[model samples]
Target: MLFQVGGQGTRPTFFEMAAAQQLPASLRAALTYSIGVLALRRPFLHKVLDYEDEFFALLMMILEGHSLRTTDASFSESLYGLRRRAVKIAVNKDNTQMDSGDRLRLSGLEKHQKVLSVAFLVVLPYFKSKLHSIYNKQREAALQATLWGNDDASFGDVDYFDGGETSVARRGLLDPEASNWTRIRKRIEAIIGVCYPWLHAGNEGMTFAYQLLYLLDATGFYSPGLHALGIHVCRATEQELMDTSSRIARIRSRERERLRGPPWLKALQRVLLSCIYTTLDYAQTGLIAAVFFFKMMEWWYQSAEERMSAPTVYPPPPPPPPPKVAKEGIPLPPDRTICPLCSQKRANPSVVVVSGFVFCYTCIFKYISQYKRCPVTLIPATVDQIRRLFHDM
Candidate 1:
């Protein structure tokens, strides 16, 4: 059966679970883009962006660690009215499928489960990103080596993206042309080339399968990470969600009753406490609204034709006519095959469409680019008007 909001201890519906899962990733992507934009203005932010995976991972570690410790939910899960619980299987001594033989208990996760989950959420992704980057570097180096075929290929010239050489072994291996390092690098790259795709595919395939199974109600865990840690997300009861707020209000009420401060100070403190509580209560809802608003704006911009339509472009003005008196350029060579500019036999001949005169490709291109006119006829022209000619020598 599908779970509804406010249902205590009930498993959330697939939509809710999916929303919770997607929310964090969407927020992260938006944050990353924002950081990239800011980095353009702040040069040092570029360096920070280089280790963005680790930087964001550290932030997630703190946020998720705090959420898990206090509410047994990650920030996104909590925002979606869900909380994680440990799953324990129960079986009778005979190990039979009797009425009381097979049962499952849902409770708070153990200390180790929380720690491991935090690591999986924060550390694993950073390492995965780093590995993928390394693989790309190795693949590029391999391609460069192939292209440099038998030309003193410098297999070690490729720079590792993460702060140069990571170990002592790579310290002086930059000149591997004279040693067997090139062969070793080739063998290692060959192994990575063979294994990376399979590993990447398996990871993606397993994640998809797990999500599918969860959506079909065939699995308790929505992700492989959760399954490995025996964690299940369930809807938080209304009372549980309201407990902290009520506790805070009660404490504040007692303090108000015993207040010895001036009336204005007491009132100020009360207002501040109320504001803090209100902000905390509504912050998640506000964030969800903002994200949805941004997404709607993005969709509208992509699909709306009325907004910022391409401007019509007029054709460029024609180049000015040549002067008639002294002839704008030097006289053309009498021989048709000789270039007026280079004074040599025309090679890779090209014609200036505006002037109807042919010249060597290099000579005409340089002349039109600099002078913007035909060398022989002195007619105004542009490099764009030059056309290459291909025919039998």
Candidate 2:
């Protein structure tokens, strides 16, 4: 009998097969006697019987060679080699299992250590560099703001061309309750609502950073202390509260610009100015305007008072009835199409029009289960109509 590892066709060596099988009493007795005699003649075989030691030594030699080849390589490259060897040995030993408990070969352990070391050396430094750059950019914005303030810089002077200087008192049209800055800030804050949380969650810090920069550009102001606080909060915590704070700050900056324009005009500008707004509002307001308008038709179901108060009405009157059809000149049909539901041959069969097509009563009822309206013109058909047709049938 032959023993094969993992049932592969390859047979085990003679010693492995001997170890696997339970020998008969006579054969076991003979084997014990033969082993004692062989042990006395070849004592060195017993000393060299450590299989694990030999395996480890071979693995170490291969690892040392690989280390030399990857001495100056990147963290990803080192990790790649380590993961590749680990997965291979793991598959070979554990038969395609990728569980954590699988015993890693000696080379795999050594590779893992090297990969961890490289990750620390490479990833940490790169992250530090990025952090430093962000810090410097914020500092520069603060310094610019300070310099501009010191120079007493103001928005360009508005020249009124009316030019009748007869002690004409000009009242500034500023509304403290809803200043342009406040309105803009509110709108921006609303928009930044999504972005702020993501940044705080650590899922999108880069995006938040860009948005902050955009805020600075739009508002022409900067608070280094606030920005620093935000950065610290974002980096130090992963909780929802911290994320909310970051989002609030981002939104505030955005809204500061929004207040400058009328709400409708601001919405329109947002629609026309950026592809982001276009992507967000497309289905609800753009090409699908008819659907949205229909959905927003609360006026259709309003109370009498509400209807009277409404500013506009729809489907304005026709421009004089189509010159009254002359009944005498028109020829009569041989017979009206039979109403399938009522079983009465009438002039007009009370056609159930839907999606530009007509269907008989029973056919329409069956179709209504799958569709809401007429198949031909997409007009809504009443259940009464369906029931009436069925009763007539």
Best by TM-score: 1
For candidate 2, lDDT tens digit of each residue in 231-344?
110111124323534654565457546655778987776656465333432421231243233334433546666878888857887765322223432222334464333344
Error at 44, model 2, angstroms: 68
Assess candidate 2 and give its TM-score to the true structure. 0.15
lDDT to native, each model: 0.75, 0.38
Taking the tens digit of each residue's C-alpha lDDT, what string does model 1 give over 147-190?
76434323364553443444324644655553477577767766
Instruction: Please state the error at residue 349 of candidate 1 in Å.
Output: 41
**Residue 366 in candidate 2, Cα distance off native in Å:** 99
Error of 2 at 124 (Å): 6.9
By TM-score, how accurate is candidate 1? 0.57
Off by over 4 Å in 2: 1-89, 92-101, 106-127, 143-393
